[model samples]
Target: MTASPEQIEIALESKAWPFQEAQKLVERLKKFGNPKGYVLFETGYGPSGLPHIGTFGEVLRTTMVRHAFEFISDVPTRLIAFSDDMDGFRKVPGNLPNQDMLQQHLGLPLTQVPDPFGTHESFAHHNNDRLCKFLDSFGFDYEFKSATEAYKSGEMDVTLLCMLEHYDKIMRVILPTLGEERQKTYSPFLPICPRTGRVLQVPILERDLAAGTVTYRDEETGKLVEVPVTGGHCKAQWKADWAMRWVALGVDYEMAGKDLIESVKLSSAIARILGAQPPEGFNYELFLDENGQKISKSKGNGLSMEDWLRYGTPESLALYMFQSPRKAKKLYFDVIPKAVDDYLTSLAAFPEQEGKEKYGNPVWHIHSGTPPREELPVSFSLLLNLVSASNAHDKETLWGYISAYAPDIRAEDHPLLDKLVEYALVYYEDFVKPTKKYRAPTATEIAALEDLIRELEALPEDAAAGEFQTAVFSVGKAHHYENLRDWFRALYEILLGQQQGPRMGSFIALYGRDKTIDLIRKAIENPRV
Candidate 1:
């Protein structure tokens, strides 16, 4: 069958991970269309505290799928970044304001709890506002929904009644999965204690389905109170609420971390019993730290979205989110520079790439099929080290090294580099400046260093960065250094007097071939004491 140009584009995109997910979504839509005239994709958040990198991840990945969906189908789509602010606040985050004030509100709904920081109405509101702010900064297009608002407005009332109607059936599905003690008095409904304003999971004394109310005996006072099953009077257990949300919102697709596999399965079953088919979903593995442990807020070990943006760009972070999500990967401060490099590499090659390879480029996904065409004059890591070597205090000073290395480069040519210079300066101050080191080369290392200096002297002053780079590589091979690392170390320690620096070729090109040779000779003749 002959395919349309749009179909060909989508088919190319279909080869990628998230786009592949979107293509699957299109296929499913053909099987069963949403009667609502649009496909809904949801990614949920728990606003117990501040949003993290993982929060950015889910929304970004879902948006990629949405972008891919647009390439394939004409169906309208919406992404719901729903926040579960209705959930109880069980723990006080060490990072938030007024820790002493939070303890009094523990076990109440997060939206009902006061914001210790005094910024928003509550902790949940503060976090939700922050989530919107961050996503807006990245220019994300999404619909933000608050669970508290959704429930308080009686939007989930029908689903709430459905849960009440099938309370016995829902319990049968949930009880066996629990420990014996938890099974004794557990009910699917968690009512906000009328006296104390805390969401309580107490024994369900009875349900008046016709009246749309549930009577639950409070554990604290042993008094049974009746409240409407909806309108924020009642909240379901997480598994039950997940199903209820699906049925209420008509979510067609959602993705969650691999840790929620059981939760997703249980929610799917409950959703079926509640009279709506569960949304199709992908359970991806969670991000890990350097030690392969899960990145945790309490541990304070994972890189924050703020941290990533302070030192990295939104595009690099977007590319990081676009990588193999089902496979667990380490996300840390050290990973940022490489992610930046990989993003640049894809941009440089994007013009020539075709077919699936073109669609598969992370840049293509990062930019939603329109990646930046202009490439940076030098890689970010190279620029960072160059900044260190030359004491570049601003863009002009940094451009000095950049212009020297690539003489044709103009300050007006690269706008991305200008933004990057700001990030690199802040990054250097925070991560690099404290550990700055300078050491003379060992007597054994000096001979190889001198040989490299002679090679640099022979290279023409007009040599290109790549040509000078080749000369540096040849010198390393000739001297039988273990590898380039050893040779580069010699250059850094003996000349720049640091354990590591930028690529010697580019550094030499910018630092001047004559000055480089002169410095090496001076070091050899009068070794640093």
Candidate 2:
């Protein structure tokens, strides 16, 4: 349901990162006079390299902001996942196949480079397919548009003509920003070399506004050529291309990394120069790698989309993307477990959280409107620990422990938990296969175990969950262990053979009070952890 503007403004103010971005978007929409029909949000992809996590992050965050606009304005909205495939292949990637073949098409646009993988028409199209495939796997709602098709089909022709009409004016805005050497040869438009079929960034010999043609010397062959600034014959330089797309598409919102602050600023200026206000934009911080280096498609430092999904669920990846846009965080494999647990934990709270709190949650935005049918009986972390302890070969064994812990849940009811069981068991074997290092328990540990057994046995079976928890805590305190964390850690190490496990009381209550007593007694009687 669409919320009133006033209601959205109040809700946005409560939890926005960097505060007021959503409000600013709302205000920008209110003040916007040129276009009054629809709200258009755009995200860009440069298919020169394989799409990475940053690509995923941009689309996910853009979707979040897009949802905010939809909730507030009720305007018709479209998200364009635009690919700059017409961008020149300046360098070959280190990770991809056929580096030497890519080197052969160095100056040509990515759309012209032969596909090294041979699955698509060209290198750029292959990456584009990869991007679309990955996003489709997550069910993103977006329209994919390519620069090659946009220009060739005359979709951006009017924008190109306007840029040509204001060429000298736009050049003045961009030239000063370039270095001394670049300033000497910069032209707003990079004409595709008609002879060589390569994109040529050359000094403009002349431009005729009446003819809508630019004459330039080829960067490669030095042969002078004249081509219409419109059509597929030419494309604007990177910064100019950005401005043209905005005016052409009437975009309302977009976002980029902080490194593009200057680029965004410059593009906004050029957009106004070409007779349209720039789209409202958010400059988010970049994701860094383990070494604090900014994660790049070239560096290949961050985990691929395949790696992330293999290790965790799409919801977890979405949660990782759902954090404050301005906060720079490391995206490594180690973050997967917490992200998975966090998604499950947040989901488990949705049915219980109050009106404002429920609406304020990221999962609400992550789902666009409705949250998942959250029936997660256990977190992925706790399940992994249980899987490790039980040496669970399949879901049946894990289900035995899980059902006892959550008696009301059925194996078929919670599909997310069923999925987690599969992921958790594999993850346990690969990442958390702990050695069984049972040791002689100290007298104090033995005494604490005895007290725990006695307390659990005396508890009424119909006791509230809090009552069960209190009984366990009381036993820990009775053994002179006031720190529940320390006491719990001892129990985990002794019983589960790990440094941690699920909440002790909850685990005991679910695994059956009687079964827990037998396990603790076995440890105490054998003097073995």
Candidate 3:
């Protein structure tokens, strides 16, 4: 049964983290006439390179909140995703080919840096465009704001002035935050000059808003550096500017990675001094690599959203994102299939009344609110082969086949079959496509292969399920199989031609008698020498 929309809302509200910081922001907003009926969420992007899964997680959670609000309230909700393309290049991502180009473009606005791929005009634009495509694919309704565009429109001038007015306070916060070495060389902010391709040192000067010019004396050399600022093109110092921008933009809530918690806290203090409301903030943990290290573009350990989409469906990806962001976790390719299965199960658990609502249904809301089950789909490669070979069209038939052979999947009450099927299709299209041409197996792996086949053949075809499982185990023992570990290793080598596959009985059952036999025969015939 599916859940009703009201129930889903209740479920979501029930799961909402009691964000003390957000509650404070909400209370402060009440002073501004309760703002009538709108929830605003902001997500920022640095156009350094390919947007990782972490980026998707941030926006996706924001979208979840927006939906929850729409479900529970009569007022509209808006989410804005801003790309910081105007920021200067700190370091070129490792994936890029030319390190020399980055050096040439160092200290220049990202908008001016040349694209390593030569596909886009600038590195920042390339990544920003890629991120935009990813967001659209996921159906996130977000207004895209480019830092370049925001600055050019004079929208940030007031915020810039606010930072300059409190420059001493900003410097105090910034200097102590940086290491002593960096503090010696660093200015409060580095404003990029497009014409000169240099970071123009902006000093304290009388603001001439009428002429759009600022005059300042260089702190280091005591030399005067005066420049005419273009209406759309002045830069702000990193920390001070960041706080000012949030208040100026009226962001209600934002989520940051664990690394930025300290920085955002300092920004909050700046917001109070400026009498501007700071956005509600949550710090989510990072997505780690299979090696258990933080996934980073610089380290070349991060996976792109596009790459992950190739291996799993968007919703399955959403399930991955829904996994506890507070805990440090590793997400490997092997984990996606189970995520799909779990999502489907969650969807199935909803009562029918909740399913009828198109948006904001209580069942879905609850499902969204909870953490995904620890179990994920069997494996993408295994599922691809099963789907490729199966005659079944719907999830129910496929799962029915799975339940027939796998005792773990309870036939009567499992709700996630539809969700599993959706994930299967995506897995096939994305990850499976590249592997379609590979033959099943060869003679090099035939000993382990033959042993598994011989054992399966020895089991009585008409035997009861438990009895069949017992016979299969007995055969492994007779053959002196080290454990289920060695047995599965042999099975996977024979079936999928790899080191692993889905649970054996469930996989065979899902593939059906004819297809399973055919695959085994193919493996025997084409054994890799």
Best-fitting candidate, measured by TM-score?
1
RMSD, candidate 2, Å: 3.2
Error of 1 at 305 (Å): 1.4
- Ranked by TM-score from best down, the candidates are 1, 2, 3
Q: Return the TM-score for candidate 2, rounded to 2 decimals.
A: 0.89
lDDT of 3 by residue, 1-529 (tens): 3245565444444554422233444454566644536667899887776677888788987676555555444445578898888877877777778888787888677888888889998888888888888889766789998988887787877766666566567677777888877776555445454446555545445555555555666555676555545444467666666776787787778889999989898888887777776787778888888888888866668567766665566776776676676887777776776765555555544444332332333224334434334333344445665765563456666676566555586534444444445567666655554454434443534554565566667654434445444544665676666776777666555555455556555555455544566666676786432
Quote the positional error of residue 303 for candidate 1 in Å. 1.6
Residues 1-529 of candidate 2 have per-residue lDDT tens digits of 6787666756665574422555566677778753657778899999988899899988988888777767766667789999999988898888888888878999898999999999999999999999999888888899999999999999998899999899888988998899999998898888898888888878889888889899987655667789998888898899999999999989878898999999999999999998898998888889888788898897578888887877798989988888766899998877888999988877878778764577677688788768876776567777776665556789899898877667888868878788888888777776677454566667888887888778888886645557778887898888788678988888888887777678765666556677678877877776454
Better of 1 and 3 by lDDT: 1
Q: Model 1 clash tally?
A: 0
The Cα RMSD of model 1 versus the native structure comes to 2.6
**TM-score for each predicted model, relative to the true structure:** 0.93, 0.89, 0.72
Each candidate: what lDDT?
Answer: 0.83, 0.82, 0.64
Whole-model lDDT, model 1 = 0.83
Q: TM-score of model 3 relative to the true fold?
A: 0.72
Candidate 1 lDDT for residue 236: 86
Error of 2 at 322 (Å): 1.8
Between prediction 1 and prediction 3, the one with superior TM-score is 1
Query: Which runs of model 2 end up more than 4 angstroms from their true locations?
Result: 4-10, 16-22, 34-36, 219-221, 434-472, 475-484, 493-500, 511-529
